[model samples]
Target: MSDGERRDMGSKLSFGRGRPGRTAVTLPDCDVPLAEMPSPSLLRDDLPLPEMSQPEIVRYFTNLACLNYSVDTGFYPLGSCSMKYNPKLHEDLARLSGFAQVHPLQPIETVQGALALMHELQGFLAEITGMHAVSLAPAAGAHGELTSILTVRAYLEHRGESRHKVLVPDSAHGTNLATVSTAGFQCLPIASDARGNTDLAALAEALDEDVAALMLTLPNTLGLFDQNIVQIAQMVHETGAQLYCDGANLNALLGQVKIGDLGFDVVQMNLHKTFSTPHGGGGPGAGPVAVKAHLAPFLPSPFVGQAANGAYVFEEPEHSIGKVGAFHGNFGIMVRAYAYIRSLGAPGLREVSENAVLNANYLLACLREAYDLPYERRCLHEVVFSGSRQRAKGVHTSDVAKRLIDYGFHPPTVYFPLIVDEALMIEPTETESKETLDAFCEAMLVIAREAEEEPELLRSAPHDAPLRRLDEAAAARHPVLRWQREDQA
Candidate 1:
């Protein structure tokens, strides 16, 4: 029950079911009749599961889970990645017996409730983005980008075009460009201008019939919404290139602006980011892609549906792209997102975005004097602060981040967007209170001072963490994983 007795300091893992030096279980070496092992090659071969009492098993995992630092536990301001708090109510709603107990392959009429939820979710996403149709497939954000781009390929192919290039801004997330290049297209770089938004001139030069699409992360990596989005969209559209909106920043402009109205031919929503789902350590996430009616046929198959008699069904589109996942797109995550949508409705969702923007801007105000604002514009849900000042003090952004952990704060993503020098991207989501913000700011200022006073301390920080800076070579070369139950063997 207490922290001292629970966590194992040296191992960096908690005392759990098979904890190295814990009296977790007492299974006899000799098997009883029911526990007798089957042959290894047999289809019904027994698993090497431990034998433990109910309370022990429960306590074991309970202690282990606590060792994890979740958004539920504390502040996780890993910017560009909205590590916002996922409400437990969403989990409860998702696990309602009617929903949780159902099998995916159940007949349409039987699971109408689920189908209806999915339909409404699709509708909600479409409404949010101003798109015609949405496909609740594509497991994660990168997956969604791949899905939308593939649809673009299919669309262009239908028009007898064989475009091979995707115009990606220099400041775009690595995943965006990676998805493009991986999808068998040349990734053409469009540089960012002085203000850090996509350089329109570079984009104009990149425009050609050979370019399949231009991908834009709305409220892009710099955390500043592109100023010339309309003009940029039109320019891309002019060259007969499809415009893809990486809706990772949908958290910022949910009800305020629609991507469909903003001229995006395809847009994907990170339901986990916008709708409050835990990033299951890098996710079993939902990135539903919304597109105009013209691209509907190319969507992934087995999308949820609603029958005329208020029944829920799963159906494949006539011109489908086959299956993306086994059943539905991370339906549980989708359920959480849907629940979040229903909980917030329209007005509350808008406030979620409004307050998110307000929070980021407030933090921006707090730090602009102390740090260099990469792009001094009204940011969306996050703001990118350049650690140019700290770098001048012989400390990089990485040092600043390492120092933050010692102050009991998780670091923002560093050296990202690959545009700004020593970028420290921060997203203080709407959930944080002003007091917490003030405390975080105070820590930042203290660190800023430390950067000047004892640069070495900042350079070699996170001394308070369970482990200090790891030897990357040693760690990468030899990663420890899992526990061995010597007693069981």
Candidate 2:
């Protein structure tokens, strides 16, 4: 089949449609005594198994892979998501038999080497964040928030206090509010000032004995580092509340600053984001939560520690939050993160953050004229721009995003933080070279001009892509998750 025909016919090729009487594998007759067959009711009638020759199967998947996009393939300037290039070296180290083949159920005495890695990783994370201890239990950034919130509840209960509120900035990640609600706490929104910093007055009024924690994203959703973070932490601490730092933007501060020193009582690090692990597509993530000495007692148990014999062992905290995950939490991801840290020592990690900030600022400067920058200040790893300029020309933010697809690039985040009129959040991670940045900027410039000169092109974009604009609402509401005979035309 030709490429154009394949694209026009839809990328999903049902495995057995084109070929009949084809099989990739052939099973041999049973060599041992066979057991009695199970009941028909217990067996599935239709397994929907794909039947195809080996070559056909490989080609089908290869074609589908080409249709998809990933960080390995192109520039993914996803803001707040930190879709940076994960080093292949980390992948190699993570796949080593010593790390990859070990089962979690093995005795601690036998897996001392793995335990040692985890113990050293814990210490490295704690030292990096200026925390006393770390727990590699939570599975993702949002899960980390939930774990921290639960710990706060436990700490407040231990103090015999009834604090039930959590303060979050208006520009905070939406996950913060959801996490607070899930933890059975009232979430109050603190407004951002005109300069995109957290409104100090609003935060002051919000802080009270009833507030359990103040959840702040250091460099918030808009990618602006809160200038008054120290003051905010002090205020929250004075009111008998803990300060929880969402370490999602740690990419912008990697080796430059530590959260614990900045007065945060608890923090959660995204191993997949800042530390370079394969992430996205709702996947395998590690969000290790770190805490000060006071809150260390409430951390999740089974943490790796040095035993009296100077050997690593699993140690449980006295007043623990219980197990948040099975086993020791995404060991594969932890391995990748540990590899990343070891590969880049303190100085190299600092350079990572420095280049990230520089790249973001460069993009901001190049595209500020085309897009309206809501907060015209220096940004960290990402920058948020408004699409009101394009909208005025009858091209919405979504239009520009779709047009980017035709330009051979994935779109940056859009319509997020819910504060800007039409937000276009862009994060050019440090992994990208200057040439990629310039190409992306050139695409945006071209799109801006097209929006003015040819509004219709912007409205209906992705002209060169394999697929055109889809009915997103319908797809969401009535998702076709699997292929069936009826779907075959």
Candidate 3:
């Protein structure tokens, strides 16, 4: 079939073309006596199984894979996601037999090398974040947030304190609020100032002994760093509350600053985000939680420790939160992150942040005239622009995002950080070259111009894509998750 025809029938199953005797697999004859099958009621004869040959099945899935966009295929300027390209070297290292083949249940003495790697990774993360202890137990970025909150609760309870509120900034990620509530604390939202920093007056008004912690997303969701972070930390500490840093934006501060030194009591790093691991697609992620000395005792269990005999071993904290997962976090993701840190070293890591900041500012400078700047300041690793200018021509931020697909680029995040009217948050990671940045900027500008001249085109966009604009709301509210033949449907 032609490509267009294939695309049109992409959603259909592979059930119809199979001949009566065709099969993808051929099983050998049973060598022993057959076991009795289950009762008749337990089996369903109506279920249809696809019977395409092996090659046909492979070709069908391969064609589907080609339709998907990936960071490997193009520039992904996804803000706050740090969806940069992962190094192939790391992939190779993680797949080595010594690392990949070992079972998690192996005796500690038998897997000393893997334990040593984890031990060194813990120390490396501690040194990078300037924290007293690090626990590579949380499975993902949001998992790290939940872990840190639980640790804070444990520490507070140990002190016989019953702080029941967690202050979350209006600019924080949705997971921050959810983490707070999930940890059994009420989430109190703090507003952002006009300059895009946390509103100090509002935070001061909200601070009290009852506040357990203040969860701040450093550089926040707007992709703008809070200049008042130092003062903000002090305020939280004064109210007898811990300060939690959601270090998802740590890409903007790799070697520039350490959250521990910034007075944060605890911080969670998304190794998958900042450390160059593959992200998204419902990750196998690593979000290690780091803490100061006071909160160290409450860290999650099974952190790597070194004995005086120079052997690596697993040890639990004095006031542990127990195992957060079946094993010590995602081992494969940890390997990738460890490789990322060691390969980059200190200076290369610093350069990562510098280039990330420069690329973001470059895009900001090039496109500010075409779009609305929500916060007029130097952004760190990403820039959040308003699509209000395009909206004035009846093209919303989502429309602008859809138009970018036709320009052969994945759209940056839109209508997020909620504070901006028509938020277009863009993060051009350090990996992209100037040529790529310039191309993206040009496409964005072209889209802006088209918004004015051909608003309808933006409204019904992605004309070049295999599928046009979908009913996103309908898809969300009433999803069709399973597939069936038309007659059954």
Candidate 4:
């Protein structure tokens, strides 16, 4: 379109807040401030950047943030991803004077408050998870998994046992499989039984001297808590292997059961998930891994330890896994998590888990009949519904997801928990009210009916969005990371 036409549209009431699309600029003629800042090399010219006025830049980003849906803005029912409302109180507390301004290189004595908070957080997390110690050193959940695996490996290596494989349930998080592989252990999938729980028979068969650990996500990706979990842990123990609980779904069981009491020798919780910290594109996350007393020494340093003089200090573990990240965890994320923990206390946390489970079950009722739920049983904090019925009617899970946009709600996670064909995974967090869930259910059921009555509407969905479905294959094959035009001399 012509610049005049673009400018005309952008001057409207609604569009006035948005910027015109990026206008590519040629080098040497660039009008950005960086264009005047010369390169370090004497012979080189100044760096060229596209020139954008303040208003244009503001409008451009405003439009971009609107493109995204978050727990802060809407109901994000991404199962296993616990996109719960990040309490604003936690954000406020995290940024308090003492917490936010701490320097990483400052002497331990100088940052006593920061150190004490970390020490208390460690103790609180340990008590919550029923572990001997906590290491708020891993940057994110997956990083925590890596840290746990390394610790398990160290414990095994110390005993002169060289285990080669880590048993991963088929229902386990994809990251678990990847983590084990990256940590130099083979990921052996233990298939699920008819009950949507890990197949005890398969796990028993997979168990052997070579298996170092069995990574179990209690309420597996299907959101079904394995009833045989305790027995499964025992079986792993019998085989002389550690039990690693992927506590991503711990939100579903908080205050209900403790994984430590359930026989998880090493476990990692996505503090960003269960503890109500922010989660998104790139984190500021804390994924503190707790371990049975035996694995404590191998934890990442420097763990917060209480000194004799009533001061908290960073002390290295006996057989440390070294530093997981540059400093002690994501300090900012830890602050948020610590705030969440203190605010919710013990019983309050349990209620959060209970309410989360109740919400999921409530949402599931509205969907179970219209959609095909592979496992028709009590779910935890999330439920997985299949779009196989819709797919038969010529609408896919992806199409159904896009159509949800019209209802002013973010779509549930689609095509996940791989076992279910055309899966739509939903998690209505504890914070959501019954009304929001009912609306979500209504939107889902309406979409289900439309899939049958007007397959075309369901097929060519997301009619409201500025962008529509591109040929995904072509887009991926020739990804346009950024916009470009013919070279200008």
Candidate 5:
């Protein structure tokens, strides 16, 4: 049978299979007294709940799980996101009863062990980034960015300065721009020079007494380390403005260099990305912010502090920016990250960066001939390539990404950074083996060949997947969030 016929048969098997009056669970009688029922006006009896036997429900969900892609299932080379493989050991450790089952509101004396873990994690992060203090309160990367910006704002305000503008590189992450505005500051975009570094001339012009901070993403979205970072830091400080480093790309410099040593006043590290915690799926992630001594007073509140008696306690900074989260940020994620650091130590962390850089450059060397290399410099942890050549043959980067699905590999990030035309950004993180990289590269080369010889194949791709290419634009603009039975439809 054809692929379409098979898909139709599968869909038929999936839907409308629930038998009436069937139940998956048998609930025991309630032991507690029941509350009064609400009025009928507040009730709904026509909910489309599925009814199926326990075995059938298990099989259905198992099939659904098999259809999803994850870091554990295959190679994920998503560029800026750093989709690295998470160690199951860390997951098992995080699930321990003491760590997983503790309440955030428990008495401080009872949870000293958990508090000590956070205290030590803070110190480890500070040492890793060479910062004076760290706060484990921000929940995600963007939250960290917002927290850092707010801290800068508070610091400047405390000094009786009213700086209103924050300088952001043109190739910086979208969150940087949004964070600046959300912190009640104007975001000014700085142009990148021909060599893909921040334009020194434009930065000089942009800096003045009104500029609050220069947010720099080291080894920026282009994956090229800025050769003039020290000079840029000097320029920003000359105007009495602070220098903020977006440490999302710290995976490329872990154990090799510290952001604080590079003259940044503040930096935020994504524990989920670089420190090997569970990432994606709108998840429980951590983005702890670290700062130099001068700005440490404004870090988010309730950071772990060590008393002179050697007891761990939550202490607010003198001039803190106030609480950025409901509680000490995602405690489970923090535990996993703590386990990752203690397991790796200093030497292993350095190897992480070394192998990450090596794997990325290997892919760059193998694919440069087939794809367009926008910049001809050595990349740090990720490589950004342009698909303008394929676009010339009437095949776009999104088309190439869709075709990758046919080869059983997740697609790299495409058309991002908003600087390169038809961009295909790939990052083969340290966890991937050379053999996996080779197989992915081979599939890409074959797709490149098919793009030229048979452009139509690229235009309509992923023939083997369970679902064909969807109208993503329409789906985004008009989302169907609820499911309904065929009779209701």
Candidate 6:
């Protein structure tokens, strides 16, 4: 069967004819008198809902699932997102009844085991990041960023300082500016040098007494580790300002260098990215913040700790930033992260980083000839290539990405960090094998050649996807979030 035919078969929005009195299931007769219906004014009329039998509904969703791309299905070099394939063993562990069934609101005494796991995980994270404290609250990476900024604010206020600005590098995660503003601080942008490192001269000019903290991404969004990080930390500290590490790129430095050791006062690690978790579709993340001894008091509340007698307990710091999550944040995600850590001890964790770096460099070497490497240096865990070479031929980064879908792979992120012209950020995580990497390189090379020989193919690409190219701007500006019946529309 043709791909178009399959897509057409799956694209039928209506599953069953909505004839009057037609029912998908036969409900049993009421055992007793039926309750009185609500008044007409209080009830919704002409409700629009799909009517399908259980089997039909299952088939519809099953077909829809086949249309979507996933980490399990293919290579996902989604740059800073760290779209690594999650290990199934972690999923199995998270599903265990003891871990899965425990209520977040259970009494502390009744949930000692869960608390113990969290406490131990906290310790592991502290050891990993070289921080004196850790908080398992904050639901996602952005939440963690906000939590870290707030912690910095609380610490500054407690110390009788009134710093109103937080410095963020141009190459920091896209969320840093928003997080800084959300925490009620002015976001001061630090420039990136020609080599993609933070421009030290610009940073020095920006640092002052009114600056509360410098929010930085280690191995930053460009995937280049700042060689002057220690010096940068020293410079920020000299001005009585703190260094806040955005651990979004922590995957590149696992067991290699701890952020706290680099003189950072606060750090937030994305458990969903560095540790193993099913992180896509905007859900189920744990971004635990680690702080130095001086800032430990201002961490998010209710972190697990060991008591004097060695029993596990939930301890809130004296000067906490308050609760960032309901209960220890996304316990299921924590379970998966814990499992990933335990399965891979310190050395194994180090090897994960090593292989991740190796894979990224390997792919970088393969495609640099075909694409433009703006930095022209070693990348830690991901490589950003400019599509300007192809753009001259009327092919942009988005065009290259869409063409990748036709070659049976998910596209890398495009036009990100807002620095590079026609940027294509690709991060092939440690989980991918050499064979898979080679296949992706081959596909990329083919697409690059096609971009020159047949530019129109790149322009109107992804002809193989279930849907054709969409008006992305309109889709975002005026999204149709829900299904609307033709009559209703």
Cα RMSD to native, each candidate? 4.0, 2.0, 1.7, 5.0, 2.3, 1.7
lDDT of 5 at 137: 97
Model 1 misplacement above 4 A: 1-64, 308-310, 477-489
Model 4, span 1-489: residue lDDT tens: 344433343333332333344443434764655454375556643323445656666666575555566777888888888999988888788888888887899877889988888889999888988999999999999999999999999999988999999999877788998899989999898898888988888888889999999998888889998999889989999989999999899899888888899999999999989998999889877789999999999999999998788888789999897887897778888888888888889999999999999999998887788999898698989999989988988899998998998787888888888888998999888999999999889998899889989988867877766555557899889886753332522
TM-score of each: 0.89, 0.96, 0.96, 0.91, 0.95, 0.96
Query: Any idea how many clashes model 2 has?
Result: 0
List lDDT for all candidates, in order. 0.84, 0.90, 0.91, 0.86, 0.93, 0.90
Runs of candidate 6 exceeding 4 Å displacement: 9-11, 15-22, 38-43
Model 3 TM-score is 0.96
Worst 10 residues of 4 by lDDT: 9-18
Candidate with better lDDT, 1 vs 2: 2
Clashing pairs in 1: 112-312
Model 2 TM-score relative to the real fold: 0.96
Query: Candidate 6, TM-score vs. the true structure?
Result: 0.96
Q: lDDT rank, highest first?
A: 5, 3, 2, 6, 4, 1
Q: How many clashes in candidate 6? A: 0
Query: Which one wins by TM-score: 4 or 5?
Result: 5
Alpha-carbon RMSD, candidate 2: 2.0
lDDT of candidate 6 over 1-489, digit per residue (tens): 368756775566753434445556898988998787777677875785667666766666777677778998999999999998899999889999988998877877888888888888999999999999889898899999999999989999999999999998887777999999998999899999999999999999999999999999988888999999989989999999999999998999999998889999999999999997988988788899999999899898887888899888888899998888776788899889988999999998999899999999999999999999999799999999999999999999999999998999999989987899999999999999999999999999999999999999999998888777878999999999987678777
Query: After aligning candidate 3 to the native by TM-score, how far in Å is the CA of 217 from where it should be?
Result: 0.9
Between the candidate structures 1 and 3, which one is better when assessed by TM-score?
A: 3
